[model samples]
Target: MTRSPFTRRTVLASSAVLASSTALAACGGGGDEGGDTAEKIENPDENINPEGLPIVEEEITISFMSRRSNASAEDWNEVAAAQTTQELTNIEVDWGLVNEEAAIERRNLLLTSGDYPEVFYRTGVPSGDIAKYGEQGTFIPLNDLIEKYMPNLTARMEEYPALRTGLTFPDGNIYSLPGIYDPTSLGLRYQTKFWIRQDWLDQFGMATPETLEEYQAYLEEVAASIEGSIPLGGQDMGSILTSLYGTFGLANHGNDAGLIDLDADGKVRYFPASEEYRDLLSFLAGLYSKGLLQQDIFATDAAAFSANGTEGLLGSCGVQTPSGYFGKEGDNYVALKPLVRNAGDEPAWHAVRSELSSIGNFVMTDKSEHPIEIARWMDFWFGEEGAKLFFLGVEGESYEEVDGRDELIPELLEDKTVDEALKPYVLYLGGWYPGWATDDWFRGVETSEQSTEGSKVVEPYALKEVWPAFTFTAEESQQITTIGNDISKYAEESLAAFVTGDRSLDEWDDHVATFEQIGLADFVAAHQTAYERRS
Candidate 1:
């Protein structure tokens, strides 16, 4: 067997790697007591070509576990992209795909039953689980694997330091790969947005509101004029209220206590405890009191919200895109700029999700004998050519170059009776490969009239400052899981009560005190330590 240059030196198991010889023997200890030998299959010397496609010279079978979407081909073997990839790379993957609905349960069962695949693709492992499994020797650390066999991924990490930082565990080893993305895309550039009914504004002979006062007046006027319509509709109170909180300079996401950030003096401060947050709650309470906001703001279901939007019963909404709920009726909605509470204030700060936002897209388990081959196979997808294949599919078949820009042809997107047009290409489109979404992809490409117009309406309002999704150390992770969960639940419950007038604003101090009592200080300290360590 050929040894990989990236052979891991550390103990494959937990801190008890140096346990008694009897115990080690019981655990199938075969290598150095402290360091385990790399598990490998027969090396295909000719197949180790990193310079070209068909990464392995001969056919190599690797088993994979992934969550299957309805859009994906029922049989992973029949997926066009899977077939094409095999044809190109000679990597035959035996896929065990569970439906998305049962994926997590199935994944857990597979892991516990000792029937897990050598690799997991697409179905990301959570941070806590990654740390747990990595420590338990269930998942192999990939830092060494990346350094030796993954030039494409290494180059990307170098380009975007966040990718490496976000995926790295507190133990100073990486456990999984991330789905890298180009953040310059319009969709990647922003997350939460405010969309208003332009048709309503036109009918009422009113202009789009720019300031908080103007927005309040507009909502009031809409409520007074329209019958059976909500002035502001939202999926939840959090989504709608975050827009208000943004204007007040507290970029709060709902239910987070230690979504803490550095204040002007560079000390970690909890935004929810700040004066701005109280003001936000009060403002929302006033809106609720006036019946301008949706009555069922605290409801878990978004069916009513979507139904209202589709029926043109909503004046404005906080949504990622109007197209999601409004469909063709989305044309009537236009994005609202982040309203200023007052003139001369800096841009409003919404919680914008980063495009490099994935926990653990791919992982190799101890069952793998050909980890290097697996790394090489996945590395191809991170490269320029592979990105084209993963996202756009076969150019001439699924997409075509229109005036130098790659666009999915109408045949796959339009020719069918309705949404069935893309069924023929579903396999190609649904093929799983961990990589970046390129500018040519739909999310990146802003060619559509709606996308172009939506960008114009919302881009300028995007905040310069963002709450970075920082990776946590093991200690911090443990503390957050304990204290943070409690604080989040309290915040969510209190937010609903305060906004709905069930809890008095006078009780705000008591609520802040409660957060402190529930280990808020420890939560903030953990985040602060992580932030400074990263710096």
Candidate 2:
């Protein structure tokens, strides 16, 4: 496959175009007022082919706007996925690719100027805007199109009802499509796990920790025995919270801003304001006081954490894979099952990800001339054949079947990582595209033996029922945004202070009270409404 060269100059040029269009964007934008009716172009019956390749008898080009990461080809025409799709579908796309960083700004400019492209692909339109634009006529609804033309997507919706519930707005219209992952894929089921130094455990003749008390004892032993070692290496504040708080029954999910989850009764509860959260904080503070935890955790990032592990200074850490930290030394680490408060008690909470992403990946604008053909083209990505093409690129060239399994060419992996080698062929690595990601394909092609084994260790403890992506009414969305932002900021700051012993636990009541004053109840109520609507 031929690859197109991408340069820093290309990125700067795209940013320049977005910067120049800001004035026009400021002139007009979405508001309470309804938008203009979408212009309709009658379908040419003779040119349409409903179910198979070559959607249209004659090739027709339509405008498509999408974001491109730095790893992607400079020209979409040269991308193997784009080239092969065009060849098979006979639907030429006039690509309007923008840098990933500037895509949202450019999209907003086009939307406000009333000159948006015919389609938006993988631009990650926010749920609020999906509802806002769908209510207005700016984004044409795809309910009928999906039911009539997209068999693959319709079948998926039937299988996973959450896809329909999450994508549908308050008006009962579907305006966007999402990238769906196989529900059983362990890699996508959970995000992070508690990884510990197996070498240290072996040297000390200690077993894997199972309970909160045992875990703390292990950390204290490591701190006392290993010189200059951080018994529990620091991660980002959110990751640290996510890795530990579940022992106290708080479901953090690694999203500091959206720290709300359903309780045992399936009701919306703000975790940061709960008694369980206070207990978790006190536990962390105790660890900090003993020097068992990293002192500069608030400032520590992934790079710093990895450095500690690489230097053999971390006894344990919370991360997806140790390869990201210790490189070839990752085999010395082992993933631990979620700890419990006491032996024989089950772990109450485990982090999970929604199969359907929160952000919409594909949408049709009012200006499209061939809605049916476009819907069919978009739906192709959901099917098995098209999914393989989009994810693995053209067969035999980018990947080949060996022993009844698809694998990348061995020569491509000699010097470059799997990601680096596939940049010239595949459009996306594992995400940011609207399609169905299967466990077989992802595990076979994208993951390593180490990652797969780590996933297996923690899969049994994962949450069986997770909250699906919820869609709020536009009014509810605005209210949540206005109030939730302040709550999130204040909560994060308070958490850091309390953990570091800068703030005494006696003032915990005052901190909880402040959340109430910041409209925490209202913020939670809006989420509850959305959750109930999904039911």
Candidate 3:
């Protein structure tokens, strides 16, 4: 294989190379001995020469990897290479960016082969993976190191129980320092928002459809049958159709703990077997036959979806997120209002879901020679200052103070696009919508006037309920993980069959049964258990 000079993450499940193999193997142990790997300090007064850190002039390389979407590791890619390094810690970094596909392969090869770097950057192993490796003696336990060094990181972990919980594994020993951000984000960015094209509605002289039945009537007319614009556009990954289920008052479609919600009193039943799901199917099926359904709904990516939303192609369609749909037109789409009930029936929308992380499952490798150093750097990124540097660029250059606040001053770029002056300098937060991570990251990156001028605006029609069933527990995690993998595959297949009209609602019973047979109950139980535990 031609290995990209990027992250080499190939999954190799071999033994983690450890120093004491015979004794450890004889003892039949793979859990943390919970002992510090640092040389034991017989007396802190004598042995703890904790006075100084390595100076910037005394250079050492930190070879870390990220599962990089961009693929190439440029010279300026190192987090510490920016001006803030000299300003804060005075540490110079050598960048070794790696590709993710071979991440596991290299990780296994290094740990088993025993030629790992002094510091493993972006090892690409999960917490469970950490536990497995730590138990194997491939990873050093971080309990004492965290206590002795990393006071700033320790302060935040002590403050947030969740942070500590995330870092510490099954045996009460810390493995990897978590890539922490604010536990509570401003709000859930990944949400379902139903968007209607103001232009299409205006062309038809139609008032915004409020109820599901009314919307259906509109969609049917627009379905290219009765003579309006194409009423729907479909994409598989996007959950616009999921809104059909949401209209029936189901919150997160994927659930465990119990599919049957206990009311303020109490109740029990399964969701897939519910009448709401049935109605959703029947209505969608009807739309499909009428040619009102989106043909490419199952295949479209986010870019395609955004094109439709921005281009005003349909009368109304499914979009769980409103931000992209709203701007450009600027308050044109009545995005935040409640949809009316279908016919004379009740109107219900899914509870607003929160707690979606920017990245799923940040990982660490077992080849860390300086776990404390690595953890310290990661913890700083989670803290107030590090968060600022990562999100916003150096102060004054990117932004200015205004009315007791830091906000971006609008600057036209060379391309003549209207972007904040700071945007080019500040490292982008992958795909996360702006103002996420640290609100403090905004400080001095912009002027108050500019910040206030460019403040976020949401459609008035957005949903208004909190669905707290977000986080999953360890036991529940095992089940959810299993089901999630299967569910995605099954969902794709089932949705395809339905969209093609090869399968009808007549076979809905069989479909539900199939899902259950594939461990739907276990999945639901896990999510429910996690929800209750976290709550």
Candidate 4:
């Protein structure tokens, strides 16, 4: 078997000393008096199958730690997906459920106190922590385990090499498994888009905007013609601004304070200090001044945005699907093509979500007693049977196959929405999980035709080369966190000020200078180093 370059033995050998020392300290001593080490559970050769189910002959239980949704059942054993998986694999799970709000603190406490469950599932552990813990031997490296035990995932990695590259750390080891998706799939590629009121466009006899000027002109007309209409209404100001950044030929990179991206020359550039960001802010300020944008865009919540849309007061908005805000009335809205800087210029970008999540979805700790069994157990999710079970639920219960398509039961959709109806059975609806996502489940059952069409409308213009999930050294990660938190808060506040005319754009240069003084250059340099290393 061809192993991933990320699993090279040379890298592991080099770090063995550091790992051993850290492991010893974490265990409180090196001798027998120290904490228990992971033990291999002996199973009969006939009991284990590399590519099939019933992973173990006799049923075995493993401890899993993860955050649970408020709507989900309190016990994992009661959840439909868990129950089905246990039946299929004959591997029971002892779940350690954490409340969503307390997940982060609890995760940190476990890591710090050296008290770990056998596995972490859907805990949203960041890549940096994965690297830090993997190096310290708190989280065991999964490279060899993946190659040896996870044949389904190994085939997937072979088919989509990017999946392996995306999940590998700098030390050439994989510490976690990500929720995988097809990169070219339209549903994942164009997750959110700028939408316009087709009814309002017809009301004014205006065509769909093709360029920035036309887009602004349409908004201006809507402000002048419609009574009490918000030309552009959005609940999240940051996301709304991100949607427009592409028109100015900028990649909507990073979250919060780490707003760095590669330039035309592939050099890292901090966006808040860039000339393109300035132009975008200037255009937005003009929109705010002209009463075309929502008056309380910064303060508007989802409920308020939905209320405005329900009242037919929004002429345009940014959303994953208009149905979320307008219900069936969303049919009046149409997904607008990504507007270009000029009439003939190619659209540069749109909202895109990566096929792989940035955070660790599933990981095994050093204390797992049955590492091989656990690896095989986890691999089930990447195969057809497990994916179907996790995504669609039981064959007849959650969904029924109709003419080769998986469709939700009519009774589930009668009074409740698709999500509300499915929440009781599915563990994480429209959220991240530890499995491969199928386009069949997503497009056929999860989304509506309107939403799929909306994604298709913007699919051609979506950015092809968005930033990859980068892994940083522990020192680099700490520097980024320390500097990024302050920078992100400042940038958001400054953006609000500039748009609302509370802060003059004339002082934009000083704002840029403040960013520089606040270690913007260092932040970009650190990211650049990581990008170059990954390349």
Candidate 5:
């Protein structure tokens, strides 16, 4: 909700608009990698063939697009995130990155117009898009191709059968390669948390808040008693509170019923009209009227809000992740307690949307003849070694080791220390995950002059749980697009108006009615049906 330099954008560098063709001819029967047959990849550097499966000798460029960072585009710098396939499998990536905003339209143009790439290179094609394209003959179903060509990917698929199911269509064939969102995927992504200034709390003799009433009371203290700051500032998670109406808003998942859910089979469900949402709305309206809520919290960008916060100007604000949202500078901050609205509320977890439904990323085209070779090449990106380089940076160059753990180097933290090293160096330009990022990825540069000081500032702390829903179908997805879009737009408009005194909670009943009229009912029904099918 709060904008920042690191913030994900609404637009993308879409190039699926171009139409062209390339051919893939089968090479000799795939041999053991790099001309080695009997030897196994036992050592990190020594192990090459995916357990004796050969490296793709074919030199091809699979052009693709993304809504997020394509570090490859940044400097053509060889960081682990993008270039690992070249390093290990000898596959060259001819990447075509698009801005996030125009990605969908561009993707549609490229495929429908008869032009296609070898594959979606770690592209974030959603299940619906995969299904629609597969149905349209634009995407090749991957079962046989994967079995024949991609042992490593198949092996990973076998390990996570749920992923196999999630990625599978009702017709029972998987149309696209899947990116399994694992546990470590949590702890860093899409967590909506309210950060309160500990230093200010100490100054005002107020303890961290754990309930809605206490939160309100805390804000009053911040506004009236504190000299120059608004009592609280929060956004993003605003939907969670907005849904409850007044009782208890956990502000996780989409929070609004009919927006999203997990059915018996652990697939995504829409839950927009659930009674719980009304309570969230009422409570937020009350906060808006009381001035305990910072009216501009949602309206403000990350820089403005952070500028207010870095100097300790505000008491509380909401954020996606605790890491850089408040500036991850060692243990300068800590979580107080997860909050619940009202006095006798029960504790609840934010829904798994944080992990599930990765908004669109890199995907390949359907025109290539060598699906196996392309898939195999893509497999190397997540290969064990590739995972390490993409996440850990260049190992010895970006990091050092101590006690069998990766740490930062002296030069890495010479400037603002950990912050400078962690941003472009360790993350975007040179990320770590090639095959499968192990727990070791978190242990950055363990043996350094600033290792002692930087680790304290750089260690990961916020909390996020992976969502269960991954592959919602095309039909179900259409329903989601129709209803969720309408409701979300209305909710945002209504919420801002209420907070700014353009409207009042006295008309809360009408707001509820309008939400239902906009097909929130249809949204929830479609999601439930899809959830049952996925299950």
Candidate 6:
């Protein structure tokens, strides 16, 4: 079988080194920052109580380490919602904020430096890191704490069993708090999609492409009519193709190493090892060979993709949302409905699983001065009052309740945008879910007519069975990392090469064999084990 055009040997070697080195670095240390020698600090406060109100009227302070936008004028303390939280909880926070760009590095450094904050909020801690540190007692398990003090969180877990299942580690311990969004499918049901220039369609009296043939024909016409145009392009062609892979009955859950996902019947199937993947490669290859798609699809960076789209030089693109890549100026581009080559095929497009909650939002360390008090403060976020405060703002000021519905006034959005105005009054930090983000909140805050229309177009084709979020055993985690990194690299390189005709599909058998040689079976099995555990 023909292997991917890239060197798998080099990639595997590099991955092995990185995994080994990082593991060593994480494990080897001395004193406070060192791995085994770092003594876990026990909270000495004897009067701690987590279940009651006014956690501490005596003005206790806790230090937090989290990311702050380098561009925004707002700091954690300056956000109105956080200020109100301080007043309500009677807790002052010493914010140890770092620029967003350096957040991960800074977080790692702080973790290893012996001197760390009491709490980590929206810290982006990886599952591996959480498992590693939690086992070492660097971070304490919150399972008991939640049952004792977090009524809101506990209730939410009871309502959504998956929320608790997703967050629980293999050891049956909960180490982090989660952010729960409102339970609505409208906002959370889809992922990235293809966007096309509607103006070009209108100019040529053409309708949006509905089938693979139609899309290919449209691309040909666009290329023929427009000067120096790329009919199809993407910021990351590999990722774009992966997202669209489901249109051919092969789905990828973006972050996973194994392109294997459970079918409706719960059978494990790997995309790269299937005939559907070949059909996709051939279709894309035909496009590249015909000059209907960008020749340098894989080489093009995000800047170039945006530049082409913004300048109206490209006919279509696959993006997370039109607004993110094209802005309002590229508003002429409309989202494309899922297309199929044949009549009987399912139009399974990329849809991110609807989220009721986000895991790993916050974590408490053993070094915390008052774990119980902090737990109480964090638990407030899950309550009705706290949810309203975080999602909406002060009643009558930011929004008003009419007929028992929270309605936001348009005038409130007139002076400063919803996010801007709400910046001072709430946490509003990315990735931190304080619960209660409703459809109304979306409509009030950032929803535009174009976005609403686009959502409608793409919603029907959303894929149903996505890979659920699950934690891995430490051993399984390392194996997935090393094997997955190499396999994904090979798969991406091979797919791109096949599409571009740099490598022929005639060698496809050899390519499949290469995966086996590189431990594809082991990778798939690891994912299967995790999937079954979650189920």
Best by lDDT: 2
lDDT of 5 by residue, 1-535 (tens): 2111210111111111111111111121122222231121112222223333345444545454433344334433343444543655665565555554565566656555455554454445655666556555456566765676566667766775655655567677666655444433333322343456666568778777767777777777878877776666643445334323223333333332334655444544333333455456556667767776666766666677666656555666544333354444312444434466555665454522322223233333345544444656656545565555555666677777778877667777775545456445443332312234334564322222222232222223221332345456555565565556556777777666665667765676666667666665666667667556754
Best by TM-score: 4
How does model 4 fare in lDDT?
Answer: 0.73
The deviation in Å at residue 245 for candidate 2 is: 4.3
* lDDT head-to-head 1 vs 5, winner: 1
> How many clashing residue pairs, candidate 1?
1
Q: Give candidate 6's whole-model lDDT.
A: 0.69
- Per-residue accuracy of model 6 over 1-535 as CA lDDT, tens digit each: 4434435565468667867766664553223432221222133244554456667757888988877764343467776667788887878888788777887898888777656777887767877777777776677788877887788889888986656777788988888887654444344445456778888898878888878888888899899899998898888775457556667767645223236665556666567867788888888888898898888887789898888777778788776555655666577888888777765676767545534345555877766766777888888877778777776766777778778777765677676655666555556435444354555544331244454566577667765444446687766776777777778878877877788898988888888888887877877888788877777
How high is the CA lDDT of each candidate model? 0.68, 0.75, 0.47, 0.73, 0.49, 0.69
Q: For model 3, how does the per-residue alpha-carbon lDDT over 311-407 read when each residue is reduced to its tens digit?
A: 5555555553333432464234434234555555545544333222221223333444334444445445555555566556555655555787555
Worst 10 residues of 2 by lDDT: 32-41
Off by over 4 Å in 2: 1-45, 252-257, 264-266, 443-446
The CA lDDT at 38 in model 3 is: 44
lDDT of 2 by residue, 191-309 (tens): 56678888888888889998878888889889989999998875676666777666778874333226777777778889889888899899889999999889998887878887888
* Cα error, candidate 5, residue 120 (Å): 3.1
Q: How do the candidates rank by TM-score, highest first? A: 4, 2, 1, 6, 5, 3
Show model 5 residue runs off by greater than 4 Å. 1-54, 57-84, 99-105, 145-162, 184-186, 235-258, 262-272, 320-323, 327-332, 342-345, 351-364, 416-439, 442-467, 470-473
- The list of candidate 3 runs beyond 4 A from truth reads 1-61, 71-73, 76-83, 100-131, 134-192, 221-228, 234-237, 241-245, 252-275, 317-331, 338-353, 356-366, 402-405, 416-424, 427-484, 521-535
Give the per-residue lDDT digits (tens) of candidate 4, residues 369-415: 77778899888878887777776677789889889988878888898
lDDT of 2 at 401: 92
* Residue 83 local lDDT, model 3: 50
Candidate 1 deviant stretches above 4 angstroms: 1-46, 113-115, 252-258, 300-302, 415-420, 423-433, 443-449, 465-468
